[model samples]
Target: MLTDSHTHLYLKNFENDIDIVIQEAKKEGINRFILPNIDETTINKLIDLHKRYKNITYPLIGLHPCSVNKNYPKQIEKLFQKVKNTQFIGIGEIGIDLHWDKTLIEEQKSAFRTQIQWAKKLEIPIVIHCRKAFNEIYTILKEENVKDVGGIFHCFSGTIKEAEKIIDLGFLLGIGGVITFKNSNLSNIIKDIPIEKIVLETDAPYLAPHPMRGHRNEPKYLSIIAKQIASIKSIDIHKIAEITSKNIDNLFFKKNQNII
Candidate 1:
């Protein structure tokens, strides 16, 4: 009964054995997975995954920030059409990423703002992909005034100050395999943060946790992250699962279930 708040289950990385990978993860109690679209190229695959596992696979539609190049406006327009026609779990895996290329900084900002605005208009939550552009992302968030929409800051590796700002903005920090890294320092930063503002994610086929480090990640590794977080907070693993499960559900489903 855990959620991998952010993952790319449609990517070719998991193409060879997606079924086996998913089945194994279900055995680990990682049931639901939120799959975010990379761009137009991935929409069909994402839809197929959701169709195959409707209950367990939640699909979100959006043009990823990295995919926000010169042709992004047209891409967004197409995605908007999809949004109008159907319901999406969220609007995301969208934001600025300076890690790869900085030339498209302004383009990324524009794309992020447009998607955020769309989220506000649709009353859907967002899944942000921020990498080395916290200030830029924060500035746009502030400018857009995202008061009603909530989201998960996927693969959050920001500072305590940034964490405070994110929490203040009504967003949850998406805890992933990075938390289990030897020097991630995320363990210390998130320990004091309220558990209610945290959610579990693997960002799988990518950032796997320790012991599984340097290996191709999968949704099954979410249990490792959950166990590590529990040990970090010195709380029972069930409590971690309980709180995070609710946190993720609230982020996407908007239900205010009591976390007890």
Candidate 2:
């Protein structure tokens, strides 16, 4: 079985035919999905999806870096209270994103740090969302010493050096549709990284793989990504599924099996 280590199927993009999407994904052997919250506005929907697909969906709670602002402290406080009585799979899709705006860099850093501390306190892993702010995010993670809980660098497309650094810190690289894209550096990067340090994800309704690149992404398309990884790594597709699914079990389910 394949696990989509990160995806946003709770978003409105899938509202019209979510059941079809889930069914199709299962047909493709993509059985597990890790859903991360974008912000307060998405928490209810995220949790609702988990409830609806309790057997296959895993939920995470956090504030995305792009959603960070002056009022983040208040937002984080409210989110903490919402999940206080319950257990979540992890804390994240949280980190720094400087691609769109640089105005809230400090705010993003503060929010990321706070969530990391909470993840440590909660004894859960974190799912990181990093885009164009690796240095900023890396510094904070180093200071926080996130090796304690371990996590995944969601949608990782970094260099060999960066990948090595992340692996050294005890984190898995969250590989996704990007690896199948023509001209993408990710394929070359993955060749050097060990399969044990990687996990598959679709990041759907986004980053759909080749041949379906322009279309809306679905968890079912994860098989296309698996095929591409198999080609790149010179292994069978089933082997990709076996190794990556084991990686996910080790990272998310094995430790939190009782609570999750």
Candidate 3:
């Protein structure tokens, strides 16, 4: 009953054998996959996978920060239109990323604020993607005051202070394969964070855990990440699975248990 709360199974990286990838993931106890949208171009592929996988896959709609540009306003408008017309589980894979390029920083912030407002109005959670701009992202979230429909900070790799700030904002930390990297201190950071305030993700086709580093990641390898966490926390892997799955249920399904 493990859940990969954030993944991009729709990307071309998995296009060749996505069905096999999904099958193998299920066999490894990773039963649910939550696909986050990148931008307008990824909407159809995200929806197609959700339609084909139905109960096992969930979809979110939003523009990634890396996708923001001068035309972000128009892009956000069109993407919001799609969200209104469709039944997405959330709004995200959105936020600010200053890692690669900061040329469109203003545009990225504006787009992030716009999407957060829309999600707040719709009462849907958001999945955030942050890079070298944690302070920038946190400032905007605070300005938006997004505590009501708090979502996840996808691929969180920040300090304990930063983690506390996110939790204070009522958002859950999205822990992923980063926890397994020997060079990453995420395992140490997360050991002090409660399991209830965390969710697992692969951010697949990227950030594959140790032993599989530099390789194309698949959702099937989530068990390896989970096992790593278990070892670090000195808890059974089954408890990690149970608690994290329940955490996902609380956020997405409202603890319904019947929805996904």
Q: Pick the candidate with the highest lDDT.
A: 2
- Computed on alpha carbons, the lDDT of every model, listed in order, comes to 0.87, 0.91, 0.90
Each prediction's TM-score against the native?
0.95, 0.98, 0.97
Best by TM-score: 2
How many angstroms is residue 15 displaced in model 1 relative to the true structure, after the best TM-score fit?
Answer: 1.6
lDDT of 1 by residue, 165-246 (tens): 9999999999999998898889889888899999999888899899999999999999999999999889999999888998
Better of 1 and 3 by lDDT: 3
- Cα-lDDT of candidate 1: 0.87
Clashing pairs in 3: none
Q: Encode model 2's per-residue lDDT on 1-260: one tens digit a residue.
A: 89988899999999999999999999999999999889999999998989899888989999999899899999999998867655688998899999999999999999999999999988889999999988988898899999988999999998999999999999999988889888899988899999999999999999999989989999999999899999999989999999999998888778767644
| Preferred candidate (TM-score higher): 1 or 2 | 2
1-260 in candidate 3: lDDT tens per residue? 79999899999999999999999999999999999999989999888889899989989999999999899989988888876556788898899999999999999999999999988888889999999999999999999999988899999999999999999999999988889888888888999998889898999999898899999988988888889888888999999999999888888888344665
Off by over 4 Å in 3: 255-258
Clashing pairs in 2: none
Predict model 2's lDDT versus the native: 0.91
Q: Provide backbone clash counts, one per model.
A: 0, 0, 0
